[model samples]
Target chain A: MNRKEFIDQLKSSLSRLPQAEINEIIRDQEEYIQDAIQAGRSEENVIASLGDPKTIAASLNATTQIEKAVGATSLKQQAGHTFQAVFAMLALAPFNLIFVLGPFLGFAGLVFGGWVASSSIALSVVAVLIAFLFKFAFASAGIFSFLSMLLFLLGALGAATLALIAMYHISHFFLTSTIRYLRWNLKLAGITKN
Target chain B: MNSQFNKGVIEMCVLALVKQRDYYGYELVESISKRIEISEGTIYPILRRLTQEGYFETYLQESTEGPPRKYYRITTHGKKTAEDSVRDWKNFVTSVDSTIHSQEK
Candidate 1:
């Protein structure tokens, strides 16, 4: 393929990336091709030696997405970046299908479960309150009965809230550590650096 | 040799070359490709990554023949990384060489 064809293919492959990043990558490749042609190498020869544009795009996308995941500040942003990074990595190498997907899916399931459990615990406090109210409304609840129910409600809500907080931390830890693990996996796969 | 193994060494060569002197995209590719067979495209991604990691700084300089060229210069952090990597590579080669020779004997 000629320079334009190579760049066009690379651009399409990298469509998921931000436009600014896409433009920068294109610029670099364009310059390389231009320099090679000027130095007396034919466009076909230079492009051939450069290898597949899709492979080049995969490498660039993986590198960019991995960095984005590493520097992500919010949980939503982190998750999004992690997904893109992992997708790019898998596309970059066929072996990652076996090496990356299994552990990634397992850890993702754990994190998803943690979030679901935390939210359910937080929501269950409402159920406790409703149960206590039903007991008071239906029966002639005495003062001691009323006080005990109130205490029970408070204890349950406070414990649930504490558990929710702890789960938030645990899930957060898992997310960040999973990203670190992905980077280490890339290194172990010999795709990139430390 | 495995291309995966070359990937690490290519990164080191990029670091080592840029540490020695500033090089533009084509220059660096030609320099390394002269001694090692690699898909020339792989070097650009490595350069992009190292630049993002703050190990290399790039600038554009006008060329007499065509459009301005982007040049890469190594940072102090990059120099230290190059030093460590070269040292580690040497140690690894020494151990591997000895193991091979011993097996042969």
Candidate 2:
């Protein structure tokens, strides 16, 4: 391919990137081509040495997406960036639909299930304590009822506390592993520039 | 060399070269390709990433025969990273070399 054809192919492939970024990359390639020609190299040789535009575009897209993921300041932004990165990976191969998407969905489901289980446990504890208080308020005051109420409250509080602690750990593990997994996936897909 | 392994080493190589002196796109690619077989296009992405990571800075310089050229200079952070990477690479290579030599005995 000639320099113009090579640059055009690269530009089309990188259409997903922001305009500014796309321009910067194209300018860099243009400069490289100009310099190579100035150095007494043929345009054909320069293009040949540069290799395929599609592969170059793929690497560029991956770098841009990964940077977005890493630099995202908020959780919502991070999720968006991760989604973009995953889509970019999926674009590289169709089998990634099964290989990457299936495992990611499974992981998301596991995290969601763990969260729901912990939250329900905590919610049930609250419900039981509230019901016990209502019963105590209506019934005649008795040492036995008061003792039982005290025991029930203590048990409920302990269970709630344990559930909350478990939730914290589960969320922490989920957040860290999600980020690690995204980075690993990008690297495996040859999306990472280094 | 494996592309996976080359990706990391190439980052360091670019940083090391810039640590010596500023280089533009073609010069840098030519310098690196002299030693390592790589798709010349891949270096641009690496360069862009390193610059984004704050390891390198770019400025345009007027060329005698052309309009101008963008040059890349290593930042202080880039220098420190290069030093650390070089040290780690040395340690890793030495250990691997000794292990291989011993196994051959």
DockQ per model, Cα: 0.45, 0.37
> Per candidate, chain B TM-score?
0.94, 0.95
TM for every model, in the order presented, reads 0.90, 0.73
Give the B-chain TM-score of model 2.
0.95
User: Looking at every candidate separately, what fraction of the true A–B Cα contacts under 8 Å does it contain?
Assistant: 0.48, 0.36
Poorest 10 consecutive residues of model 2 chain A by lDDT? A185-194
Give residue B20's error in model 1 in angstroms.
1.0
Residue-level lDDT of model 1, residues B17-38, one tens digit each, is 9999999999999998887777
lDDT over C-alpha atoms for residue A42 of model 2: 96
Model 2 clashing residue pairs (backbone):
none
What DockQ does candidate 2 score?
0.37
Q: Which portions of model 2 show Cα errors greater than 4 Å?
A: A91-98, A109-176, A181-194, B2-5
User: After aligning candidate 1 to the native by TM-score, how far in Å is the CA of B16 from where it should be?
Assistant: 1.3
